[model samples]
Target chain A: MSILIDRNSKVLVQGITGRQGGFHARLMMEYGTNVVGGVTPGKGGEWFDGKPVFDTMRAAVKTKYADVSLVTVPARFAADAIMEAADAGIKLVICLTEHIPVADMMRVLAFCRQRGTRLIGPNCPGVMTPGEAKVGIIPAMVALPGDVGVVSKSGTLTYEVGFAMKNRGIGNSTIVGIGGDPVIGTTFVDILEMFENDPDTKKVALLGEIGGSAEIAAADYIKTSMTKPVAAFIAGRSAPPGKRMGHAGAIVDGGEGSADEKIQALEAAGARVAANPEEIPDLLS
Target chain B: MKLHEYQSKALFQEYGIPIPQGRVAETSREAGAIAAELGGTVVVKAQVHVGGRGKAGGVKVARDAAAAERHAQAILGMNIKGLTVEKVLIDEAADIQQEIYLAITNDRSAGQPLLMTSMQGGMDIEELNRTRPDAIIREHIDPILGLQPYQMTYIASAMRLPRAHWRSFLKILSGLYACYNKSDAELAEINPLVITGAGALLAVDGKVIIDDNALYRQPALTAQRDSSDEPESERLAREAGITYIKLEGQIGCMVNGAGLAMTTMDMTKLYGEAHGIGPANFLDIGGGATPEQVATALSIILSDANVKAVLFNIFGGITRCDEVARGILTAYNAVQPEVPMVIRLQGTNAAEGKKIISEAQLPHLISAETLTEAAQRAVAAVQESA
Candidate 1:
């Protein structure tokens, strides 16, 4: 079975009445995600997409039995929303809101950890288990049901790799976007562990960008713990030092985090590092 | 968002961390007046975001007011690591007995705020860490628990700080941590936290990088943003809601998504390697971008004179290809860029987007179905033009 989300997962959409929340919630529903209800603080007792709206996550969780939550609140309130979701007993918290303060996220992670909740992404595309459920912003068209589990720190790049894999007639078991934030809820090793345990997943594709030692840690983990064959592609190889390449986390600092270092680490760990995004599927095959 | 030394010192003062008495000066005459006010013996430090200001001669010690003016005059317009020194901080020079390093930064791996201190101060911490790792003492502060008093004491004792200075050192540590926490700073550093000849602990140099994500709440710090040190194009891109970074190559790239934008830049560089051409800039139009934003992004790319050719790689998910096409057409009509352009539109409504561009039949516009083809074409066009 696919990891994280499946057809049976009851999802609650936080900030479901907002523009981004409403837009992506509809897309998630269209892809057959088991979205039970919506949560908007003041807009409670309203209805969105024929689902009941609640003021608090506790009400949403209690009334609708929502096991998972997709937080689409604005950056200012995102950390609080995540903490609320965890405190309200949502097992899997998926935050789509980006740019929450680093300190706020650190506290949120601590809060979530104490509550035994698994949080994924504050700036991530969310997760998609092909042919089962769609939880976040990952497009439904690009994914096909199969065995290659995909995890990335990027959105469109994951879509590109997924589309290539789909074209190569190799579908995905699950796709998790852990986000490219300097501080995120989850890490590469966290998702890789799930992919390894999932029987439906035979191989994994990891899409990484420059910045952070997570890739190096992942490489170490892959070398020691992972048994499944993993193919990886890292972006920002051509990026210059000390420049942030769009993503907040994608920056080279003191020559620590570079694509070359990551690629070398992954290669040394027995993982095939693809030259580009399109070569990912070929590497996996 | 990196705050200049003077700015960081101002913030440090607010938090009760002692800094050398100083005032920012834009003119050499102002610097002279400030130095005279501070009893003539002053340090003129250039205000710029880049590091190694000391090595660049952006920092100078003046024995008198006249020397302060000369130093400020030499520094104000001087280029330090590609950044111009527009202002200098004139401060009363400190009599250093010893130097210490202290900082509070986010430890991404631990998911906590990391407090680092070293006796080997006034030097590159990274270089020090690489060379003598044990010389640096680190403490992880729980976001909820914060920097405990014991943690600070442990660090002070570990560094063999004198018992007499421990009390003041602890205050400085707590003050710095408080400033870091309250300001939502990614990094709050006091490099060379000097013990003065008078036995007073003072923050001789300060650096604070406010978390950009938290800037919404920090209106004061946001107002202090010095655009002079950064490229004008970057500032424009930020205002336009585009994430842009200027490069030294010729192929300008506009793509949706940060990862894809970087990859597009890499691919462009890879293909252009043989031709000695590469991406001139990294521009991410971002997801769900409107036509106006896309047009603005295009304008920013075109604004870079080094750009010989422009590449548009849009893999539409939340960002629709049709919207991108409309924006392209809008920019094409508005800017009338003379550079050859290549467009690759895939994912949602790719065909519709391609059809829209082809139907427009804009002059010097080319299309590719794949990223590889688009990069190849973009590089080839730049090479051909060169």
Candidate 2:
């Protein structure tokens, strides 16, 4: 009853030869994710943890069908990586790379949108359908299959919220990390709409920080499109004005992008606000 | 990664856009010598990372070399919004026939570069965009083919640039876009892209923000960065491989996780409002930072003169709270800021962790029962400081 994935979904690892790709692939495989095949440019007929490796994604697609593709390549090459996966008939693509140039992401998003591919993050933590497919870098030690659907832009906080939820015997249907890149492929509204439509997901835990109109846009969606209980925790209430860290889009400008401003907007939309990370689990419950 | 006007103009010139003849001077003597060499009325602008300098007494019109020297002396050592200036940009004053604004940046919603243009320039364009939305001409450019001739023409027409001047406008736009792509700029802006009385379309003021990630590839640009423009603490953090952003609040934040950092700040405000306290800054030492790094992170937060109290929220998984506590103690020994600190230790080894902090016998440091209590304690401490 997970949102983006379930037990039947098979996953493919792109750029599997790289360090981050290899590391996360093993983690997903260890977590019992149905990691079907690995793709590298020239390293074919190789074996990583008893899985077949192919030179190109096309070859990998022909031999093994992957419902989701995790793109772990560098920023400059992320666009081509996603396009290759989409052309090969992969339905979902989770971009794990950070600092993907904004312009490159636009072209990739355009290419994927035409093909009807669901892109999770160009800077996001990949999706995790708990107790099923853990395709992202979320600490699976804390996740359990439950009714709460947690989505966040911050990586480590996602783990914390998941830990808090698990601590309270509240498992999660799925958790999505919408990376904090300014020009990410997916937004809060997109995931909220997805979580809203998933009947297994009884509640949505939204984690946002100071930056952009994403929070505002999410509030607009919740007010109109979504019909589920959304418990949101807007972080960076004490964010320094007009400074950006890690994420390019994650900056405050002209005092407009503050955590309080976001929380107020979310509260106006009828969502319960978790003032602290610990309060998130109880709010979701 | 904001570029000063003079630096931005350097990039604009590389893109073939025309700019007022200018040189950057660090000393009043240099300012006078450069102004005298240019032999005209000059604009002396304080070189700081912040905006609103024009109103902050950071920018001034100098009638001649002597005035330029006087203005430079006033600006170079002046403090604009906590950023002390060390350089002044001396430029030939423009004739300004017509002024317009143009900029390009990432629009997260459209997942593309948003080209913003307006006929209204030299002031807060936000006001105009809010009041008269139609006044701001915007287009989402396709990244693959880059900016097209037709799109530039559309913007040129929207700004009501004389039909005879469309060619120059098109050239500037192309160069700007090229500069944006080639230079790996996150933002390339020419506010008041002026048309001189001599009928020349020029980028009088330029701002190019190079993407920090791309700095490895752009060595020439990497060298051009003025670290003096950044806050002393921010530069120190950069050198330490920590991402620290200074904020104006009362409660100082020190958290191990970026996500936890945000939640700590959010909760502090929630609790602060409940108890009439506010946060002074947001600090994320990052998960897996050594105890020493944790202590260093604390010192940075305490370095802010505005901070009244410190909030430590460490979620132990990849980061152990006991290690973070040790860092706090180590940092306390090093910086020794006479401020209150409240820490909530959770995840791996939570109890053994709380005992460690208590055993340290540190003054003004409180051990909390939970994250809520910790945030409340921090806010109360800050309010007490007030």
Model 2 global lDDT (CA atoms, 0 to 1): 0.82
Over A1-285, each residue of candidate 1 has an lDDT whose tens digit, in order, gives: 899999999999999999999999999999999999999999889999899999999888888998999999999898989999999999899998878888999999999999999999989999999998999999998889999999999999999889988888999999999998999999999999999899999999999999989999999999999999999989998899988887789988888899999999999999999877888877887
Residues B12-89, candidate 1: write the lDDT tens digits. 999998999989999999999999988858999998899898999999999999999999999999998888889999
Q: On a 0 to 100 scale, what is the lDDT of residue B297 in model 2?
A: 74
Task: Give the C-alpha miss distance for residue A279 in model 2, angstroms.
Answer: 3.2
Against the true structure, what is every candidate's RMSD? 1.2, 3.1
TM-score of chain B of each: 0.97, 0.87
Q: Choose the strongest candidate by lDDT.
A: 1
For candidate 2 chain A, the 10 contiguous residues with the lowest summed lDDT are A238-247
Off by over 4 Å in 2: A15-23, A40-43, A73-80, B248-252, B272-280, B298-310, B318-342, B348-366, B379-386
State how far residue A102 of model 2 sits from its true place (Å): 2.3
The iRMS of model 1 comes to 0.9
Question: Chain A TM-score per candidate?
Answer: 0.99, 0.96
TM-score of each: 0.98, 0.90
